[model samples]
Target: MRIGIADTTFARYDMGAAAIDELKKNASDLKIIRRTVPGVKDLPVASKKLIEEEGCEIVMALGMPGPMEKDKMCAHEASTGLIRAQLMTNTHILEVFVHEDEEEDPKELKKLADNRAREHAQNLIKMMFHPRLMEKEAGKGMREGKEDVGPL
Candidate 1:
């Protein structure tokens, strides 16, 4: 199966790399198509192209919004576009976003981006190859970058 990874240059961390590493480890046979763009808003078009043109079954949209109000707004708009792309293609585009304002330390933010990407990579793997596994974990507050907060 083909998988797509769409990332941005504006991000402080290389989230796509982390997702690629996780996918390679867990699902090495997949044909991963990676596309890099200028910023978060570009991911929707890039991801759509990966699915419609490149024939990718699913995509991972990785981005890190800067610590600014304008950055957050851009992230929201990007997210809306991603949803629209998913509806248009009838495919899954995992939106993995790590906002810079989430943590005060740059080091922590980088770690969050890496962890979030890796975790979503696992989610993509499960979606493509092991849907039953995902169902089993339903309602479990499983997080990627930090600890998993179990379901209440």
Candidate 2:
């Protein structure tokens, strides 16, 4: 299967690279198409193009929104666009966004980005090849980059 990786230039960390590494480690039969855009707002079009034009069955949209009000707003807008793109194309585009304000330390931020991207890559694998595996984890409070909260 073909998988698309769409990332942003404004991102401080290379989450796409992390996702690619994880994907390669777990799945050997996937063809990955990478598309880099200027910022988070541009990811939707890039993902859509990857799906419709490049024949990707699924896409991973990785972005890092800065620590600011405007950045969060932009992230929301980009998310909306991603949802619209997914509905229009009938394909899955996994949105992996790590807001800069999530962690105060840069090291932690990078770790969070990498872990989240890798985890989402695994999620993509489950979506494509093992949907039942994901279903089995429902309400388990699983998380990436940090400890899982577990079920309540």
Candidate 3:
């Protein structure tokens, strides 16, 4: 099984890395695949840079969008940060956590989270696959003896 740890601080990074390394050394059946730096709205760039430099394969972003009155700006920031990280690294997965209010119903929150998960999954898939699709198109054109094909 592949395992990944996500957290916000540099100490967390170091501790997670060490723990993952220890896990790999002690357990041959387990694979410590990635270590991700979780992103907050104000620290997105720094988190992305840490993930890229550490060669993490997945990122989990925590977005506290506040209430309906706040306009949900932090959610947008988290998504933007995830996109930026996807572009910078080999990250294949992005998990977003939504802050819940005390008065919110669990079932409603679950449904909303499910919808958001699907939407984000589609967006991420499109972003990740579009480049590969373009490359495939170029390759097909080249194979068909078309000289106008552009490089990927």
Which candidate has the top score in TM-score?
Answer: 2
Model 3 over residues 39-145: C-alpha lDDT tens digits? Answer: 34544554465455555444434333445544356557666766766666655535444445512776655545444433443333334435564455544433111
Q: What is the Å distance of residue 119 in model 2 from its true position?
A: 0.4
TM-score for candidate 3: 0.41
* Candidate 1 per-residue C-alpha lDDT over 1-152 given as tens digits, one digit per residue, 9 for 90 to 100: 99999999999999999999999999867999999999999999999999999999999999988888999999999999999999999999999999999889888888888889999999999988999999999999988789999999
User: Who wins the lDDT comparison?
Assistant: 2
Evaluate model 2: give its lDDT.
0.97
**Candidate 2: residue 138 Cα off by (Å):** 0.5
The CA-based lDDT of model 3 is what? 0.44
- TM-scores vs. true structure, each candidate: 0.97, 0.98, 0.41
Model 2: worst 10 consecutive residues (lDDT sum): 143-152
Q: Give the clashing residue pairs of candidate 1, or none.
A: none
lDDT, each prediction = 0.94, 0.97, 0.44
What root-mean-square deviation over C-alphas does model 2 reach?
Answer: 0.7
What is residue 120's positional error in candidate 3, in angstroms? 12
lDDT of 2 by residue, 45-147 (tens): 9999999999999999999999999999999999999999999999999999999999999999999999999999999999999999999999999987778
